[model samples]
Target: MSDKNREGKRTARERMLAERAEDEARGRRRKKLIVGGVALAVIAAAVVTGVVVQDQRSKPETPAAAPAGTIGDKNLIVPVGSDNAPSVLTVYEDPRCPACGIFEREFSPTISQLEDAGKIFTNYHIVSFIDRAVPGKGSKYAANALGCAQDAGHFRDYHDVLYRNQPDETNDAFGDKAVLINLGRQVDGLVTPSFEACVNDLEFSGWVSAVQQDFDKSNFKSTPTVLLNGQPIYPKFNNEEITPANLVKWVDAANQGKQVGTPGTHGQSPAPTSTASEPNNPSPKAG
Candidate 1:
């Protein structure tokens, strides 16, 4: 009776161990499948993201005929009326945006005069949300072209030209390549081959896009959005209270000699002037 009981128990224990081993093997298989699926999903997501970005870079950009102005990055930003200016306004501008243009023409001109007066000095931080328009102004090839122009020493002139001649958002601007080249030519001895090469080169263009993506993550909800003292600038659009004269007078008050657009008065949101095509989607408002 003892031997039979022992044998039965031993057989039962062996079967249990074998079943446990089989179950463990199944578990490993399931784990591997899950890991593999996750990897595939990650890779697919990356590919799709890349494809969408590239597609944006591919849209035909109306090339404004390269201007023959003395074009180049004007490392110097001039805000109107800036004279011994006590306040500083820093701008993050995207040239292709209509709002940005509005910011420039409607808002910035007065400021530029202040700059001219040495009352307030403004610094510009340019970003590219659209692929076309002012070179180095947006995310793709235009940015590279801008960099190239900057390298040649005409960033500001070129920037102004690009904006002055910007086409409608949906319409195309032809001759930007040529305009850029001609403008580059104005620089004493800009490298022609190198300039052309930069325009065609997509690698550096990616750098522009990468920069914009990084910018979007940090600041406001839209392009041409400005920052004052590292905070967002809001221009008050109250018809009576927000006139250009008031802005100038306000800057005068703030600089009581501290760098302020208006002394006690606050501004509404900054305006944008970009009139170019957006990459992927129109610049999403800063969220």
Candidate 2:
């Protein structure tokens, strides 16, 4: 081969080698960039996860403050009447529940009579599930107010007042602290600074939630779930319609051989200065 041709070939071969080296270098740089990006993304994700976990850990859990004179499981019950009564009446209710209002209006007088006579002890489980289904804080607020009333030693009296003044199912009037505080005025010696603060601050909110949780875990589906000695008896019992007469009859039957219970200092319904008006026709389903 000629000298000029050999020189040209050598130069071209050198250029080709240089280009191949450059391409490999570029590939290595790209691989490094890809690996670095992946590492950064993984670190960022881990940091975010850690922050979320830390935030969750830092948040304090709400404390449950049950009312005075509470009894039964988890201190979730507000007892009325006499604990020594032969028959125990378990009542699960919600303040915002229209059916519960009806139950209270219709049966409260009879129940009070029975309590005064020391025939049955009533255990009230106040829940706030209505706030979940309906659009309002009335259930929670009213329940908290009820707790405040209980703390003031006027649960039964204030309970009757609430039902009498109960707003419509959709109305959230009870959500207003002012409304609750004003209602407290109806009960003799209930509207104190502490009672107002308790209602406004939602003092017993955790306790209401606990009661709601218990209701959710139970087999009961709706409010005003009245059980006589652990037996369902609100709407019916033994295939017969439930009435005040039936209730007394059932209690008498249950206490046929047993001695009548004397009224206890706790859980007794005192005579209210005012009377509760009649409840509107409520839905059959008390939810």
Candidate 1 overall Cα lDDT vs. reference?
0.48
User: Candidate 1 regions off by >4 Å?
Assistant: 1-85, 131-139, 174-176, 183-197, 200-207, 237-243, 258-287
Model 2 error, position 66 (Å)? 1.1
For 1-287, candidate 1 gives per-residue lDDT tens digits of: 69999999999999999999999999999999999999999876543332122223332332323212211122212122222236655565654565556556676567646655656545444556554322333334455565556544455445555566555443334225555556555445564786677666532444454445544554344556543333344454223334478767666666573543332101111121321111222232331
Which residue pairs clash within candidate 2? 81-267
Question: Which 10-residue window in model 1 sums to the lowest lDDT?
Answer: 263-272
lDDT of 2 by residue, 1-287 (tens): 99999999999999999999999999999999999999999876543322111111112223367787776556667878766677878788888877788888888898888887888877788877776655789988998888888888888889999999999877889989899899888888888889988988899988887777666656666667878777778688888888888988998898788877677544434322222111112223322
Q: How close is every model to the real structure, measured as TM-score? A: 0.48, 0.71
Question: TM-score for model 1?
Answer: 0.48
Against the unseen true structure, what C-alpha lDDT does each candidate score?
0.48, 0.75
Least well predicted 10-residue stretch by lDDT in candidate 2: 50-59
How far off is residue 151 in model 2, in Å?
Answer: 1.0
The best candidate by lDDT is 2
